[model samples]
Target: MGRWEPNARGRLEQAALELYAERGYEQTPVAEITRRAGLTERTFFRHFADKREVLFAGSGRLAELCAGAVAAAPAAATPMDAAVAALYAAAGVFEERGDLVRLRQSVIDANAELQERELTKLATLSGALAEALRDRGTDDLTARLTAEAAVAVLKVAFEHWIHGSGEQTLRHLLGECVDSLGTAVARGPGAAGSVSG
Candidate 1:
């Protein structure tokens, strides 16, 4: 994929996404994407480093947005609360394009490499959240664990949002997930005073 072209970035990304969604990530090739977009091989390379990069281009930026949101939250907000707020803020950036999220998820689910990349992206976002928390004077261990738990809740909430009824918006589902997590944590290892005896 090396035929230099101009202004093909968006087209290339759109084409890659379409092909990935249509034929699965493993089966779709750079050439196929460029062909569908009516562009040359060089055009694709000029726009994206590779086919997989297209799926993850915005991941870093999204992580930054999430961390920023967390850092900006009021001091009164608990760490979990701040993380959830950050996730909700990021959802506002994402809620505009339900189709894109679904398509990307489909591709990632169908391909191990894409799934790995997604996991890595999630880890990166979690780390960013932890760092942002530290900036807010949260302890390191608390920040790390809280960030990880928040992302887990976000993942569950996102799935519920995507596959379940659309009536429960992401924010609402996130709140439910947070509450569920809190309840679970409150129960602790013994659960319902089992260890008291």
Candidate 2:
């Protein structure tokens, strides 16, 4: 029989992040996390597969959010438009969790393995998004490139948002990043302006 724990998962996550920031991820153990959370190892395993998953719990949710947003975007929307919609969806999911997400990023930034895991998760999201775009009648190659571009845009927007001051939304940051990227590409040599021939 399993013992019921009230808010055990949340407790575990909070404790794990606190310990990770204080002692570093590699130096922390499941036993210590459970102890800090005042829960048992069984309770910890009940909520998470391992310690690493605690920080990445949002990945699955964010992937689902992005794919669903892309699928639900207007049929007449361009690939970039659909991608922007998906980014807005991600912003909605992340907006309320800024502090926790920042801490998770901090922990990941300080660790190579966690950084790899973060990249792997983003790759997974890109593949899922490409599949979603294909379902919206896009060609495979175009869908793939579009999804990859979306990931890049999202990454840049997130970096800017995390490090910036003020009340800027991730959605706004995404739009600005996309606009900047478009401007840079548009102004490249031989792109409608710089024919010094």
Number of the top-ranking candidate, with lDDT as the measure: 2
lDDT at residue 136 of model 1 (Cα atoms): 93
Q: What is the TM-score of each candidate against the true structure?
A: 0.87, 0.91
- Per-residue lDDT of 57-132 in model 2, one digit per residue for the tens? 7798889999999999999998778988998889877777777778777888889999999999999999989999
Worst 10 residues of 1 by lDDT: 1-10
lDDT for model 2 comes to 0.88
lDDT of 1 by residue, 123-176 (tens): 999999999999999999999999999889989999888888788778888889
TM-score of 2: 0.91
lDDT of 2 at 131: 91
